[model samples]
Target: MKPKIELLAPGGDVQAIKAAIIAGADAVYCGLDTFNARNRAANISFDQLVGIIRLAHQYDCQIFLTLNIVILEQEFKTLFNLLNKLVNTTLDGVIVQDMGLLYVLHHYFPTLDIHASTQLTTHNAGQIPFLKKLGVSRVNLSRELNLREITALAKVGQEHDTLLEVFVHGSLCVAFSGLCYSTSASAGNSGNRGRCSQACREEYETTESGHNFPLNIKDNSAFFDLPALIEAGVYSFKVEGRIKGASYVHTVIDSFRKQIDGYVATGELTQDGERLYKVFNRDFTNAFLRGDLNQSMFIDNPRDNSNNHLVDKLKAEKGESISVVQIHSAQQQLQVDKQQITSSVDEKIAHLSIEKIKLSLSFASELDGPLRLTVVTEQSDSLLPGQAVKTDSQVFTSSSVMIPSEELSVDRQAIEKRFKSINNANYELVELDTQQLTDGLSIPFREITTLKNELLSYLNAGVAMIAHVQPPKLEHHPKADGPLGLSMLICDEADVALADMTDGDIYFKLPDAYKRGCTKYVDFLLQNPRLIPWFPPVLIGKDFEVALNILQQVKPKLIVTNNTGIAYHAEQLGIQWIAGPFLNTTNSYALLALKQGAACSGAFISNEINRQQIKQIARPKDFKLLYSIYHPILLMASRQCFFQQSVGCEKPRIDNGCMLSCDKSTSIKNLKGDSFAIDKQKAGYPSIYNQDQFLNTDIINDLSDKFDGFMIDLTNIGAGDRVSPDKVELITQFQALLDGQSEASAKLSRLVPESTLLQYQNGL
Candidate 1:
């Protein structure tokens, strides 16, 4: 039989865990108080984690801890200590976003399972084998995958024994997970570090039209696609909401649980669309799953449109049932009232009741011999509700003394009654076998109950024992050599003209959206061996193949990319590549892992890391490290054309047929009156850049020895100046600073009054 698809729910806190398990979740993924993706959520404390795990295990449910955030080098010790503490607990697995964290966890706790978080942006099958090599047991695929892509990955997973998990319901990110830097760049709050400002949800105006929230994509609900996902070999169906309330978690989990169960049993879905909507949603879309990019997926006006009548009906029904329970205890009544806004009385009742212990019994006897009774207990398989019987070897078994001869003539009905008398609703009799006891057999009611109690006690003790088993320790390696060099990222021809002014290696950033004007730079690039071509970070879907073809034709010295798909493609095309900042390389282990790739030359330290944190990175001594010293920080890169969406342009520039209206300077003003420049001249999508240039001349001296070179990113600079005076002046000052000129700082201050240091001094 096929393994039942798992329904994994989010447990934001202790209350959320109770709600999810009571709602019939097979597993609950939650974060602890620290180092988790949803740091904003009221995560459970260390004191509460053990109790929650025990409670979930009692219900035949699993608990997966979320350690999915990117970890910095300085925090490695804290993480190691946390892992040591967790190794002694009953944590079923850990969902991780950092490759370094994955390596450490896999090495330290080899027996513990590790799931690659969706933040890893694992969309293609080619990336699966590399993840599998990293000891990842499961891969939570990126939400951008289509059914065909999912199927291909599923096939790869099956061959490698790595499970494929997909998000079936959740709020969709406008930018691909892990690749987005908007919040970090604009607000200094990184999504990678669990502090997203949600700049995508803000309103913006286009040149031809007024204001609208163009980047706000709708929530994803694949309720009708459960069977299709299962057919595609999805090992787990995940629901994404870590910061949501308990009631929302319960309703969503319960609704999906019913749908999955109904489909598994009868080959048909049983959707509670209204209830799911009422739980919480901006809007709904299955566009990504269906490969329908043209579909209207954005929720221009995000509002709750749930049916009020349905909500009222559910509340009224719950009120009637809970009134009796409320009358018993004033404290319970208060709790019930508080929870009523989030959950139904049935859900509350389930939470109040402790999970039952599952047990099985068998009776055997020869025609002339004495009767024997056997009791077995083990972990429950909730999916197979009625078939909990286990073999002698599979469970802790205790045989009772043979039935007395005098009991042979006892009433058969009486024996059956004794077996059924186990009460408190705390014991689920999975199976009972009575083969040779057809004539008659009697057992005292107290004796039968005593045996059941003993088995429960044994199972409970076994659980504690299982939790204490520790994996063997592994060896740890210290810091090593890494690549050393200075590099520059040039975006425009003006920046290209000034590239030679600075004494540094240059890399031309290929426009995200291919532009006709970029062709003019080809002759210039061919003449300069120092200038390498850098690929865009947001390549996926059809654009991925197109970008690959373009890069193949360009045939530069080496390629720099942020997307893993591009890295994998570069390997196939026999092109050398360097890991970009979007890959989130925060530690030495991740750097080592990336270097193992055939195409990878080295990696850039994540821009999110502060000076002190970056200094702690233990990369190979010779590994090249490119630090961004000067650049207009990228706020966002969107596939939806802002001009077309907001300004009512009949054709977006992405279509290649529209007039290049974005060639002119365009800026979006935020609530704070900070204007972000928009460059739509790129190939696939346009990017938004922060108004201020990020300058770090003060820290260059300190970082120079640690890093091989600094990257001067000149993308989207000098937006308002007609003669590009700001760009020229900024470049001139930067060149002086690189040349160690004494007046560089004063010169830069005169040209630019205010600049952002952006995570250089303070880490997020």
Candidate 2:
């Protein structure tokens, strides 16, 4: 008989922890008071963590502590000291994401088990052996894998005799689990090591038409097949809800438990288990797991402000249960002929005629329907449970055979239709090489205008604004003249105060990065009355203090704080605040939720979003257009930069920070002391080296028409590195082109002029 799979639940708070245990969870994962994954959760203090561990152990349940957040050099001493104390406690395993942390846990707490967090983005089989060698007991596979992919991966784990864990239920991320820099790009909060602002939850507008869209919704509101993945033989099932209420966590975990049991016993997903999304799915999306769904998963529109009927259906089914059972035989194992099976309602008999093997089974049935039995054969004659089975038929050997379930059938048409009608928003203009700009790029202007008019023609169209793409440029110029026209300069107040001349009206920015520690500077600028302070997202703990002392001392025109942190201070001060794009106000709910802090929020649309989805968000709130186009999401590191040392990589220092240089670009990433070149491709695209960049030159003109400010995301630009001539040139030319000085702008107009220039323009 196979070992029973462990059911793990997230405990963001103490109540959530209790709920998980009550819901029949075998184990619960939580964070300590400081430097754990949930920065906002009222995490367990050191003493409380120890108490929780003891309490969990008393219940015969296991407790997995989270030391998963990214660590900095300064915090190493304290972190290791904390780890040393934890070693004496009943910590079953450490759920870890950072390689540096992994190294520490292994060296100091060598007896401690470690489970790789999903944040590690362990997507392929190659990582298994590597992790296994590092004393990792289990791996949480990337959430983006589909049933087939996950099952295939499970086979690898089985062959290697390692444990595999997967997200069986709860909130699903739109971006790749660990690869997303959306939070870091929008705000400086990093999610890789777990200080995230949940930026993906915000809404945005489409690129073609500036229609607003909301991202906040229930879990599984998009297109995930949780039931299918559970049946794929994952060793452990994980539920994501560390930030949610206890009821929500309990409801989600209990539901998945039933689903897993049902599939295991009956070889079928019970209706209640299959439809768990109806309980609390924001919008269901299998993400990359189900291949690719054509539509955005969460589709609540702010403009309409109507409750989702789909969500309502799910909510109605909340707390419904599903059940699964473990099957075993009192008699010996059964045998079966090729493609043959035998079973009774009360008992099951499996016979392998060729091997002359037979087995009998008896177990409690969890399904509401009839008891079903299945016998599958493998490639090799060794019939071991959890091992990959291949069909070694004399006729021809194949990979696997499935025991058919009477209750399940594949719906080809439903799957196809679901794919086709996913999301239908306007297309964003691809950044073109102005150098490659020809009649093709120019003609798109007419096409976009036509599209705008066509959308507005219908009263039911619900289109709000058209997202226009602005041309690219490198530097900010106050005065310029040409055929293009006047340009908008996105300059900081420092730039304005330091400039020799102030003839042109430049949009003054209060960069959340540089001016974060100074309130006096903000007060001085507000007194000048000449500054247009465009505030971005602000931090909560330290930066919050900076905003309070001097924010009310001066009356500023606008403030932006995404949905969290400093915006609260800005709003309480009665200043007109414009919400930042980091808030991700994709729909009405998001807008309403974020509106308490700022009067207006900026909405950005990705190429994957659709116009209808945009309309879903625009109808609710007053949004001031920020940058029409968003550059590549940038990774921001609050953790210490990995520039100078090899301390952790070699000896497993408590403080692990290292620099990584690729052929394309140089970057610093935090990892466990036992880190290696896991996968350069995943660390990020060679963005600085030209492998990936958000230089949307072709779409610039289109974005310029809809946004109040155009943007260039340079957060990833290394602090010590020299300024990028290409970026400066891109901004300079973009301003020139926006100002109608086409000749002045022409130099920086194109990116990769040789490839897809014409083809992309034609598609637009």
Candidate 3:
């Protein structure tokens, strides 16, 4: 028989985790109080995690901790401290998002298996090899991928010896997972940091096509499609609800458990998916799984659809709209069913406790013989004296001898103090039974430490103690003071003339989608040597291949790429590459990681950070730091059509033609009366942008000495019907500002009057 696909569930807290384990989750992924993407989830503590790991192992269930946020420079010490403690535990794996964290984990904590987080925006086949190179054992592919794309990537994963995990059931985001910046642009809640404000779910003013929640899509469900997914060679089926309560976790996991087991055992599903509707959901859609992009993927509401779903089902059964009295009756029935599920889950998990295992350490010593220690783990019920030992006892002999001494005698107090580490996350030193040995015995202090280390090794399943790692001191390689250069981005043929206006570099923006075997980009780059290629953050399937082709053909001296897959390819081809701003480069270590790991020449500091955050970054030698001084504030880019609900597209669904040929624009205003531009450029994905462009002159005045280049965007992507700013005058003013001309700042502020710099004041 083929190996059964693993069922992965979310564990938001101790009770939820227990609920999942009891509900038959093959594995559970959870987050700690810090450094995880789901900050809103009731994440567990280190002690809880340690105990949870022990309890999970007893049932043959694996626990994977989520530390899947971009690490700040100051947070490394705490992260390292946590990693040090984690290495000693039998943790199954860690899910990661930051490139720098991957570098640290791969180099220092080699034993911890790394799973790439969905935040990596892993979509293309090239991304598999890229992450595989970074020591990722498993990858959670982008949630937006179709079944065909997922199957193809699963095959790539098999070739690379990396496992693929797909989100089988979850809340759906209209925007791509890692790329959404909707809240970060104004609310200071960066989704990259796990503090998403759910901008996509917020109510907006009714658009021209009449949508109040334009960005909200229906929840994703692949229950009936498990057989197909299993056949696609997927290794893990992930359910996404870290912030959801234990009741929801239990219900969803139990239902899926029945579905997977029945299908695997009998080649036929046994459970109906109706129980899934009893829990909190936005209804369910499997359009993405079936590779069908259409209007039905979205729902009118973003709240719990369970009550309404029941009413709707009842009405549909009668073939008409139900009365208020009938609706209330149906909704009340849903409430009762949900209550029963919650009660059942609570009762089943009442005996499952995550409290630290109690330990009784007995020390025996006589004359000069080596000291002996016996360890017994008491049951979770707090076993009384002389009660049965729930676990086997292990005896360890010390390498050092104990001598009779009156001054420094070995007592319970001394033993407890010396073996204090024994009362840690996994084990609680509840009792120190030193009655086996006579008093007035002493051993060398270092010998006490040695014995403790030995006992710890035994407690950790005979694994040697892994010493805490202090990151090696990076050389303070500050660059020589130099004036920052001006760089401009051009997306149109008309803006190419701006290159002759200044001696500064010009970058031609590349499209996320490309026509198959397209040589136009290669020819364009070849003809325009002055224009450097600027690769976007997202490129999947043949589009990635086309981007790589452009690189291989033109072989530019240097290029800037937001995609790490492209960065990896560039490094392999011996071509220098700059890390784009969209890569979310935040700290000094990230800069170091990019340069050392992929030979990155330079990187643009993330625009999401404030002045203090930017100033704190230490530049590596010979690495350039570029910042965009002016550009449209990008909210998000999505594979789904934003035009479907905003202004209403004529086409029923999106296709390659829509991506490569469609050019449309619309706007959606929120209840706060803030407008967001929905723009689709020719040969580009649908995107949401802040109505105002980002224009910051303060960074130039405050930290010009820290950067190698200051860039301005000349693209007219998010302008909509707004009047265009003069490209020629903008270039001249940016250059002058870079040259320290005080008047240039005021002139440029007038030229770009309709811009905002809110992100500069609010750092993540």
The estimated TM-scores of all candidates read 0.73, 0.43, 0.96
Per lDDT, the best of the predicted structures is 3
The full ranking of all candidates by lDDT, starting with the best, is 3, 1, 2
After superposition, the stretches of candidate 3 with alpha carbons farther than 4 Å from their true spots are: 321-326, 381-389, 400-414, 439-446, 480-482
* Model 2 regions lying over 4 Å from their true place: 185-187, 205-211, 214-218, 221-231, 271-280, 301-307, 310-764
Per-residue error for 421 in candidate 2, Å, reads 66
lDDT of 1: 0.69
The number of residue pairs in model 2 that clash at the backbone is 111
Residue-level lDDT of model 2, residues 525-628, one tens digit each, is: 66666554444332222333544444566666554433233454555566665554443333333333344313334433322222333322232334444433
Candidate 1 lDDT, 1-764, residue by residue in tens:
75579999998977888788888999999998888879889998765776677677768899999998888776777777677667656689999999887777766667678999988988665567767877889999988778987998799899989998899998888777776777676455788888877787887654345446766788889988998999999999999998887888888888898888888788777775666755567768898788766426766665553433334454577765655334445444434544664647244634333334456667665444434557665443333334353334223222333344564443445447666654223346776666546454444445555554554444444333222324223223232354334467777656667766666677787654444434544565666667777776665544455566666666666888877766776777778888887788887767766765333777888877788887777656445666777666666655445554444554422344322235534666766677777655534355667777777787667766666677766565434332333666776777667667868977776665556776676666
lDDT of 3 at 482: 59
Overall lDDT per candidate, in order of appearance:
0.69, 0.45, 0.88
- Taking all chains together, the TM-score of candidate 3 against the true structure is 0.96
Model 3: lDDT equals 0.88
